[model samples]
Target chain A: MLLQINDVNKQYTNNKVTNTVLDHVSVSVKEGEFISILGPSGCGKSTLLSMVAGLVKPTSGTIMLDGQPIQKPGKDRGMVFQQSALFPWLNVEENVMFPFKKEMNKQEALQKAKHYLQMVQLSNYGKHYPHELSGGMQQRVAIARAFTMDPKVLLMDEPFGALDEQTRTRMHGELERIWLDTKKTVLFVTHSISESIKLSERIIVMGTRPGRIIADIPVTLPRPRRFDAPETIQLEKQINHLLKEEIDKVVKEELSYAENR
Target chain B: MQRIGKQLVFFVGLVIAWELIVRAGGWTPDVMPKPTDVWEAMKRGFSDRTLVYDLQASFTRLFIGLVISLALGTALGILLAKSKTADDTLGALILALQSVPSIVWLPLAIMWFGLNEKAVIFIVVLGGTLVMTINMRMGIKNVPPLYIRAAETMGSKGIDQFIRVILPASVPYAVTGMRLAWAFAWRALMAAEILSTGPGLGYTLKYASDFGDMSLVIAVMILIGVIGSIVDLLLFQRVERNVMKRWGLETN
Candidate 1:
């Protein structure tokens, strides 16, 4: 296993009231596999991803990366945040070059950054700042930055959640191409039903109340899956049926909570 | 270009109004000198090298005081931002000190350093330090959590994180602090020079007032205003724009 998350539990305590965000969640990721943890908005999918990234420790269980207990954020596990999280001060090339500074000199880092930028088809934006780029372009730069590290595992937390529907579709193609070309182990966290079906080799559907895995479904569809593909549509319907119950429960809870307030 | 032209128009109009008032009132040079009279006095001081000497004296003191304040203020500011103990104790003390006017330290400065250059520099440092330190602390504290998290994942830690992420992100705030510090240091310098027998614009103004040389006094006052505004326009504002542009904080 490239990464192993065993019986992970995360609880937040506020003024003696404990909120269980994750409960007994377990998953194993294989090398060079594209895995998507799909869930509703409050399903603790992101929390699980963060634990694997070593950004937050699980309350009870342990996360192992390449047979070692994951302790803290490391270069071996590259993460792409929803907001792009690009350094505003550095240009496109410099931001990608940042992670490689420890292993190489300035010239080598620049060359490697250029190589990744070419991979993402953002070679012309080397000197442009984050604010100068469009939302999709900024995310592309972020993808380039993460791919530059060539980490053992890539973690994405709804990396395309902020894009419009049109831009999001185009980015799905771009991301799939990069994932195919790199063949790095990827654990993607997202709420979109079609996105999980379109991208992942496997989908782990999670439920909300004391968030835990409810279903682990493997996507055996061939490569280059589209939104309107017959198999993609069938799988989307099946996953939506499983997630609707969890999402409806959350909606009812939120409505009652609002009414009480 | 348009902005500069508008400012020039307002400045010329004000000068014209001053000249009219002085001429209509038939004021004596001792009371209120005409615009031409003041300009003549300014030219005379420049030709005789007295004005240059006064400016050099004031600028040297300001430069020294500002350098020391920058070093001490940034160090203390980092400590205040990074350490909880320093934030709780020394931070409280600095806040209390900031509320007290910089002029309030003049007496103590004189007592500690005597009525000399050291006393003047001490007062300038006191005036500038509080503003710089406050601004620097706010700068560091306000760095976005996203930047820190991103840097951490990129394998940056400890002092490397501070240098690469925290410091660069704080550039705008640091520039703002420097601007405020410059203003404070200038005011403190004038007050200190007035008290001490320093060879600067403030001292010249005081000496001229004693002799009722209103033309020379007004000339020095105009020179002080011109120099201060020039430094603000040329140095502080330019650096601020560049930093904002590099950080992509500016739209254009």
Candidate 2:
């Protein structure tokens, strides 16, 4: 296994109230595998991804990469947030070249950044600042920046969540093509079941209220899973069946809490 | 271009109004020098090179003073922002000092450096430093936590993160700080020069008043105002607009 998250849990305390965000979630990933943590909001899916990125710490258990314990954030794992999070001060080329500062000289960094920019089909926009680009373009630059470092695991937290439907679908195709080209391990987090189905080789379905993993279903279908395909619909139904109860529980909890107030 | 044209028309209108008022009101040159009289005094001052030397002297002091203030203020600001202990102890002190006018420092400055160029420069530095420090502190404090976390995940930590991510992100605030500092320091420099009898714009204004050269006095005052606004418009505003545009903080 390239990454192992075994019996990991996270809890937060507020005003003497202890809330468990993740409970005994265990996952193992082989190298070059595409996996998605699929859940409704409040399922701690994002938190789990943060932990893997080492931006968050687990309350219990351990996460290891290639048998080394994960500690602080390292260059070995690159992350992409739902927001593009491109540094506004840096243009696209400089943003991608940011990580290469210590490893190489300016010339080498430029060449490498150029390669990644080309990979994302943004060769012409390298001189443009983040604010000048559209939302989707900014996200693409972010993706390219992440890949420039060539991290062992690429963690994306709904990298396409902010885009409109058309852009999101287009990103799905672009991302799938990039994944195939790079063959890098990916751990994606999303609430969109169709997105997960289209992108991941496996989907880890999670439940709310303590945020425990409910199932890890393998996607055995061939490459390029169509959104309207019968098999894709069947899988969506299965996952939705698992998640409907969890989402309903959340709604009922919020409704009763609001009524009490 | 449009803005410049509007400004030109307004300036020409104001000058004409001033010249007409001076003529029609029959105000003596002592009370209000004619615009042409002030212009002649300016030409004479420039031809004699006294104003040129004063200009050089004043700018030199401002340059030196600003360098020291910017360096010290930036360092102090970083210390205050980054360390809880420094902020707790020194934050209130800075706030108090900022409120106390830089002119008030003249007496204490005279005591420290005597009636010398050092005293005027000291006052200028004081005028600039406190505001710059406060602004830099605000800039560092308000950097989006998201940027820091993002950089941290990318393994840019410690000093590297501070310089590359934090510093560049706060540039808009820094530019604003610089503009305010320049305005304050310019005023402080003039006040100090007037009091201490240095070879600067303030000193020339005082000299002209003593000699009853009302035309030259008005000329110096106009020069002061024009030069101050020109720096603000050309240097500070240009830099600020560019930074704000790049940072997407543009107001218009």
CA shift of A113, model 2, Å:
2.5
Query: Model 2 over residues B1-252: C-alpha lDDT tens digits?
Result: 999899899999999999999999999888889999999999999999999999999999999999889888888989999999999889889999999889888998889998899999999999999999999999999998888878988899999999999999888888899999999999999988888865888999998988899999999999999999999999999999999999988866
lDDT of 1 by residue, B39-134 (tens): 998999899988888999999999999999988898888999999899999999999988887777888888898888898899889888988999
Candidate 1: which stretches are off by over 4 Å?
A: A255-261
Candidate 1 per-residue lDDT over residues A206-260, each given as its tens digit = 9999899999999988889867888888888899999999988888998999999
Model 1, TM vs. native: 0.96
TM-score of chain B of 2: 0.96
The positional error of residue A179 in candidate 2, measured at the CA in angstroms, is 1.0
At residue A184, candidate 1 shows an lDDT of 83
| B186 Cα displacement, candidate 2 (Å) | 0.6
Single out the weakest 10-residue window by summed lDDT for candidate 2 chain A: A96-105
What C-alpha lDDT values do all the predictions have?
0.89, 0.92
The digit string of per-residue lDDT tens for model 2 on A215-234 reads 99999888788888899999
Which residue ranges in model 2 land beyond 4 Å of their true spot?
Answer: none
- RMSD (CA, angstroms), candidate 1: 1.8
